[model samples]
Target: MTAKLIHGYEVVIGFETHTQLATQSKIFSRAATAFGAEPNTQACAVDLALPGTLPVMNREAVACAIKLGLALGSHIAPVSIFARKNYFYPDLPKGYQISQFEIPVVQGGEVSFFLGDEKKTVRLVRAHLEEDAGKSLHEDFIGQSGIDLNRAGTPLLEIVTEPDIRSSEEAVAYAKELHKIVTWIGICDGNMQEGSFRCDANVSVRKPGQPLGTRREIKNLNSFKFMQQAIDYEIRWQIEQIEDGHAIQQATVLFDPDTGETRAMRTKEDAADYRYFPDPDLPPLHISEQWVQEERAQMAELPRTMAARFVADYGLPEYDATTLTQSKAMAAYFEAAAKACGQAKLASNWIMGEVSRRLNMAETGIEQAPVTAAQLATLIGRIADGTISNNAAKQVFDALWTGESNDVDAVIESKGLKQMNDSGALEKIIDEVIAANPDNVAQFRAGKDKAFNALVGQIMKASKGKANPTQVNELLRAKLAG
Candidate 1:
């Protein structure tokens, strides 16, 4: 919808992002929470909801929640309590989820992110600590359903944002920015495919200055593309209902990727309806101020700050800076290459262009990069030292990828790929080219720049494309002009 129509009908979005903590054990038990395990094998007494098995809080999970709160500029609650969210599902063995209700571990935070050209900030309502539910696999071939408890009891930090988002674009941007932060901070892997991190977008459309419309929550939007699509479709659907003089109902919906639409799962349930009550087995969590301070001190530079530094310190364009700072690994690679080659722009070009292109083609990520920063820096140094032509340097990079060698000098020498920088040798090649292309030489004398270019091409070909281009140009100009 156009902004004007959207202005008449505000698009309000709130995000409930579940980020699985990077811990070795389950939140309330000693059972391993590792992914890809056999179904139901990871479940222990606590995870299986066996009676008389009390819950024990994991200190590491609480620490992770605090770290995330500090990163989001949120206040760490001095005391937070865990309550049982009662529900019945085949996947949920406990018949209730142990989660924070009115008292969250982190409260009143703000996450700053950008939306296109405009800088948008979203207020965080709270980030609560919770344990994840299990997964159900249904297939017709099996003719029966299966349950996987490997994901059950995994510690998750549920970050909730206020209804400040105005469009699907903003919602997607917020999710992406959050993903970057959590991944960079080493708190979560942010692998949407593996369900390490996921988002549910709550969408509602209202007339400007009117009371907010009844919101629909779209769940299980794991990927960023799906998040955008699901929210976009939900917003339109709500607007259609309002236009038809029907009031929108608050409900939980699921996005169908095959149909590109959201279908209602059930009516939204309020927390009181879940019969929230403190678990008598577990004690309330008390986060000391010193602990929060320590985590804040350990945080590495965030993406936005790092991107600005790339612009200010390295003199990179905004786009280049953004590209380089997208991931911690890419930024580290650029920094090492820049330090070695002593050329920030050139280092950025190689990393963003050739390195990025190759990684995308191979379906690899920066973490799985074949070329290390030191190797890339060394290769770029060869070009700077005039040891290899730019085209030849690319060949060296390819060789480096195949376990050949990263030593630029060694590769050039072993392959006999060094540029012919000797003026006399270039002059002889230019002489041979002039002797063969008398017509082109005459054309150059007639002030035809194109003819001189053609002659240069022949000289480069005669040298097997190893001639220094600058030397070829100078020698060609002198010989042909004479």
Candidate 2:
């Protein structure tokens, strides 16, 4: 694939995602990890770093990291250490964050996704375990800011990626695929609105084949839409500056959705600037090979693996197989429908086309769809076995979706949608159509395909759209030749 150039400069992007683990407690404390609590109410002694309170690592957080490592096929380090990242913020009551620097629990992995027809792979640097800082609230108070410590100490897995993304589309695709994996594996809730999954994109643009340019980190992009917007705006801004004979500066920026622009928050800090040192209270985390294997054994089948099985067992196209397995619910729905109807391709088409369209329109997931897999399969079966035409099947599908009827056959019968499959009856209709349209027959013999189509339309109209289209086409050709 050719590199995407923005104003004669190639866009380079990397992502740092903070995935909030689904653990019940904080990473280093027993504070509740639930959202929407009163400010500072959920903060425990350890979370607040009160005197005499020591940090104790949560085992579940470690397990979550291990689960992600296995899912990404990353090397799960048997031993990894935690360090203190010195920082000062209104929300940081501890005056420093506990994070990993020199050693991380989950090391190098890669996320692969498709951007248009091109396959792109974004290499991972490391996914380190860390604690979240509290949020600063300024809306409620007019003259002062408020600190909400409830989110502090929330368990997080900071997944870092190499700068492999060359465009905003690729970056969004990578973010979505990563979100699917973390949620599919049940590690995080994957709710971007509630801050359960947050992404920080580092974007830079440089002349082709030149040294990498300085990067600006866009912080806390909670929505994919905003992530793309932020990157695009940042890329344009940097290019504009460079064109004006100004150098791009490295800094942390925030995207404002209201204005669709990015503003610098602060100068970007390097790892060495963090003053990293091992945490005195917490020991290095250790995992046995047996533990890693146990995690692997209990993990659900990965999406890629399931996609391969769909291609091999169901004979679906690669794109269809990959799309069907996008979410676990959708995959199960497709499998059930395919098995019931014994028409894998038809089922795949319906699910990917009509079913997906309706679901998206209603803003609902497959699990919440009004039409059940069995019901859809029954509809497909009718169409497959000549009980209904494709158009008629859609009528039945609408009736089923709107609760007009539950039984596929009942809907077809009530709507009088059953196809006219009798050979003699269809022959009579075709004979009448051909006899009535001698001009069309003459034109058809003169090599006009439209004339042939007109004859078929006449037959369908005579039968009130009940004639099976395939049978009509076959009988018309036979009669035309005779």
Candidate 3:
């Protein structure tokens, strides 16, 4: 079912994700699959379809496909055929591409993610193994175009999904979840800028309960930000066209990041237009159940499974669990900190809030975080034991980040951030504040919560912001009650 209607139109979206498999060599040849090499250096005889070259299946590519199928809970076809999708392009050296059709390696599955707190699942149609087409590089500086065939035969798994996504947000969430899965399982690097992963969105609109409208496919949405913008623009554009009495046309369009608009590239073609047929040069691909089981045995715990464990073992909220398991490195960091401090919720909060904030500012990944998990756990321990306040912890964190001190206690001592937990000292200060603020105390007794808060602020300020907040609240409530 559709998630919701946007502006009285039911938006339907499907995705086609091209995830380049992480193999050392091209799919059917021995050429290097490394990126940023000199153009055309990676193309081999079979990749170029030289007269006598015959395609050889890459065992590693098939293993990666099986791994993805297992990760997504998709069916692994025992026997799948390879067909030639015939198309003519300057970058296509073979004039045809070898891809799976009719019977794909991975049959059906679903990718589930949270759209805010609401759970959404996008069903999968199939994920097929295919060869990537080369790039057509247009150089305005030289006033010429060149074909870089280095990418021509790189192994790719084209993942397709049902039209279950409703909004651009849902579409992007689905994409991110898929990206995480492929990378988590070591299938794809999920690098959009390098074109290791690419997305094409099919968006359409109709009245509630009406038949699906003709759709336009947006091509080469390499970034999640651009993907959402493209889909949003297309949705608005389609709605505008329909409102003006212009019918939506089924075509392929390109999103120009420069103009923040989508323009028609060409009329979209049907499957029949591709003239697909089983390639005479290649044989049907076959996979064994034993092979699938072997892959399953070696696979890492999935994000969902790890998230569930986090919820159960750590007593974390479902949302927290899901957020923590976004990447393997992040999950490891949280678990290590939680284990060290014996406080799961506090660990989650610090990692997700303070650590994440710093990481975002630095534009770095969790793997690159300067503060070690053990160091964070030590800092949290100080906060828990009333050795420092949360605000003080931030100072220590900043110090740790800048390599000023790796030791949390050393930083706390040097900065004098230790919380004022001495009951005698705090009590004397509270008494003085109470005596000096007679009117405020009277107003607080008259049921003004703000007066009580102001008194608490005075205590903190008098203590030089080192008073333990929890202790202050408890003692002040007792003093007022008496």
Candidate 4:
């Protein structure tokens, strides 16, 4: 229903997210899981399900899953069982996927996220460790499609949340929080474009006191914008069907980006249909308490904790802290720059404005930044200490991107871009500006405040745009008022 409809119907949402572990090798095989490789180039005999091939679990993938569980404040199971989910598809060479069925590695967690002024918590049902299936590419240029087994057997952490969401906004907030957690905990890279992270939303609408409506699963929504849109469309479609006296069907749906609509791909399959059973080829996953403790100790400060610290220590607002701590690399960059400049607010402003702008333009991340945190700190320091005017600092920052010197002091000195901070020298320029602009002085004396700004502009021009702006403004106002 739209926001205008107040029929007392509530929308419930749950999410199942698959986050590919940031490991070099696949979970069940030694095949490389790198993206953009030629089709089937990175596959191994085990990944291809060749005869006499046995699967061995990757230790790093398990550790990464535990790290995520700790970050979510979840209970880590000492032992979890893996089962074979039998399905027949071209991409599934073995006709079954190794996944968690009855006992998962992590369970009963909660994630707190902010929605505007209110902080909401979503309970996580379970986080299971699983292996990803291969991709089925359909290209008309080749007259058919082929399988890319590079993604096959890749380790994936499937995080499932309880149906605590009451609206589309809450669903988006939960997804964003999960994305941040995975990236902050160093488990997943959180690159939606590369398919490293993906979300599937389960949505249903019901009356306030009625039984829950049948839900539909929307699959493979990668971006946050698309996630919100897909949920909204699904909810509206379900509501309309119920109102029109039609029953909601339980099925799997795919979102069409071009039309911004959802279409049913197939009826949702049940666990019994998948024929889930223990795989004889692989042993049960045994996670000891010691292993869990060690991984927890290695867990970095999570985004929420880092955000709180940024607010407490750096005196930043909650919004600013949230933006700064969106990614671990971003938080590190902010902290390093803040330390070097000794002015946290100034560092934040420059990083959020100029640095973020450049990163967005280039479509890159903070880790792949052209300028380092130290370099940005030094540049802001020069501006703060009056070694370079704010305008000149932008120029210096642009020049620093060419892989030359990033030292603001060196750049200013080499380029002769230092600000003119001498008040006595600026006073002479202000006097000349007032004398030349007699009409403006007359207007100022007549109580027109805008006349003084013109005089300030003249002083700035006379200084060749190198005068300290605050010093220039003060001298011009004093001379004009006299």
Candidate 5:
């Protein structure tokens, strides 16, 4: 999809994400990787790089990498090497981070998602395994900073993407799809607020047919809402700098949520500056075909695959299938409801409409929905069997949602909401409505559609809204024709 140009210049974006693996131990040590632990309690001798302590790779961390490769349809490397990414900081006890450089475990994949009904794809360069640095805390210290090494050596899969993103909206869509994929595969928990998933966006802008502009990296966007805001502000800032005759320099920048702007942090470093060298302490990692196949065999059904099944099996629209498969829980709930009620389209409509609306308003997830799938099936069944009208069914749903009643039939019975399906009984009311409203009858026969709706409304009111709307429309039209 073409991105709408901003100030006659097109936006281009790429992304790098750090996803903390779901292993219980750190990537290169036996230290616990649990969050919120006392600053140094979880940091072992290996993680702290004490003398004579050599790094030992965690088997579970490597297993997480294999699952990610299969999930993205990427190549699982038979042989990959770890390198020392040399850098210096207070929190980096080893003075370098152990990461994959020349030979990454996962290579060459694409993430696809829908942007306003148009499908957008982003190409991935690589997803390399790495170790995290500890954090520096300044809030609690005076004229100094405290270091928390609990996060150090935590396993991370650094996923990098090509610059195929065109706009902030597209970037968000791509991010969301990738997030869904990683969490769905169970490699990462995808808790952005807890720092399990973090994104760095490379944003630039240029003329429609011109070469790509120099890009700046916006670092550590933890939430999707903040991500879009940062990208947009960066796009405008870059365009303005170029308009003022300033050359766009390559650098790393930080987004300030309070200011809604990005400020330069430092110049971006090239690979040569990192002084990458293969780690001599550990041997090259090797994986056999059998290991990759084992992981694949144990994996759950992927989202896109399940969506296709939903379309073919349930005869659902592509949009409905895609939306329902956004999460595993959502998909399961929908399937249960569909199977119980025997009406796929009707179940989809209620789920996507009323169910979703209530969920959002309450700031809750589908799993927390007070109305169970079995309860929804019962309510839908009442509507299908002509035991209640749509309007009346909504009341029953509200009663069910708020715990007013546990049974669909009970709600309908107590409220006197049963539909007037008897043709003879409905016909008497239809005749009375026609006799009292002559002008509307003449207008209807004169081919005015509003007159037909007016007569239908009067019949519903006269029947105290118990009339089945579909039945009323059919019988009203038949009597008028006679």
Candidate 6:
């Protein structure tokens, strides 16, 4: 495949995401990891890295890492090492962060998703276990900054992706897919607003066939919209800089959503700059094969596997299956409706088209939809059994969605939406339509398909759109032939 070029330069992007694990306690301490706590209230001795405090690994945090490995089809290492990432910040009361450096818990996985109609896969470099540093509160301090240690020592799985992403759209899609996997597996809460899931995008641009360009890291992109905007602005900024004879420098940048631009924060650091050394406090972490097996046994049916099953069993298109299984609620709703109605394709179409449109317009999720799966199933069944036309089904759906009626049959009956299925009655309407439009009859007999469609439309209109379309077409053809 040819690389997509932007203004004669190829854009390359990589992601380093910090996914906060859902564990209640800190990674090395018993301090609470809950959000929105008072400053310094949740910091314990181990979290603060006080003298005589030895770091003890949290068992639940390791279990969460194991679950993430299972979800992503990554290699869960039997043994991993912890290192101290030395840094200076007022928020880092420990003066150094305990993180995995040499060997990570999860390694070598690929996340696949559809970009438009094309499927794209992003390769994972590693997901290392790390502890979050405390947050620095700069606002409302009257020129003095306050540190919030409540978030200190929060367990984090820093997932690193390869530089396979070439566009902002693909980057956002990859982030969202990763978010879904982490949240679906119950390893992370996946909240971007509360800083549960944060992303750092390394963006660069180079001329086609040239070596990779210098990358500047965009730190702490908490929202997908800001992520794309930041990458795009950064890409353009780099391209313009190179064109004007300014060399692109490696630095950490921050995205200011208010101004829709990226500004340099600090020089990007390399591995040696951090002076990584194995932590003496914590010993080498070991995981038995039995533990991985236990985690696999407890895993739920993943979206990818479920989508393949849908394609095989339900005879749905790959796109339909993938879209339907985007979330557990959506997948369950689709499966229930498809099974109940025995019209998998119809159920998929309605859910993807009308149902999704309504949900997006309302800025809500499938779990909060007004129409129940059973109700939608009954409506689809009515359409399949020729009890109502497609147009009538839309009307019934609107009533159900708007809470105008709870019962499917009640809405259909109340709105007089029953299809005119009687062969004799439809034949009468077809004969009248044929006689009333002699020209259309001549044209359809002369092989004008549009004329046939026009005649069907006339018959449906004559029946007040209540005619069974199949019956009308058959009777219309027979009358025209005779």
Report the lDDT tens digits of candidate 4 across residue range 129-210: 9999999989998789888888889999999999888888888898998888888788888999899999999998888767
Q: Can you tell me which runs of candidate 5 are displaced by over 4 Å?
A: none
lDDT of each: 0.87, 0.93, 0.94, 0.87, 0.93, 0.93
| Colliding residue pairs in candidate 3 | none
TM-score for each of the candidates: 0.78, 0.96, 0.95, 0.77, 0.96, 0.98
Q: Which residue pairs does candidate 1 place in steric collision?
A: none
lDDT of 3 by residue, 112-155 (tens): 88888888888999999999999999999999999999999999
Q: Where is model 2 poorest over a 10-residue stretch in terms of lDDT?
A: 112-121
Among these predictions, the greatest lDDT belongs to: 3
Q: What does candidate 1's lDDT look like per residue over 291-382, in tens digits?
A: 88888788898777788899999999877887787789889989988988888898999998999999999999877878888888888888
Runs of candidate 4 exceeding 4 Å displacement: 1-12, 23-58, 84-96, 111-121, 134-153, 164-177, 189-194, 205-213, 223-229, 232-236, 239-245, 270-285, 402-418, 428-467, 472-482
Per-residue CA lDDT of model 2 for 289-368, tens digit only, reads 99989988999999878988999999998888878988999999999999999999999999999999989999999999
Check candidate 5 and list the clashing pairs: none
Q: What are the RMSDs of all candidates, in order?
A: 4.9, 1.6, 1.9, 4.8, 1.6, 1.2
lDDT of model 5 at residue 382? 87
How far is 439's C-alpha from truth in model 1 (Å)?
A: 19
Q: Pick the candidate with the highest TM-score.
A: 6
Candidate 6 on 112-208: residue-level lDDT in tens?
9999899999999999999999898887657777888888899999999999999999999999999988888888888999999999999999999
State each candidate's clash count: 0, 0, 0, 0, 0, 0
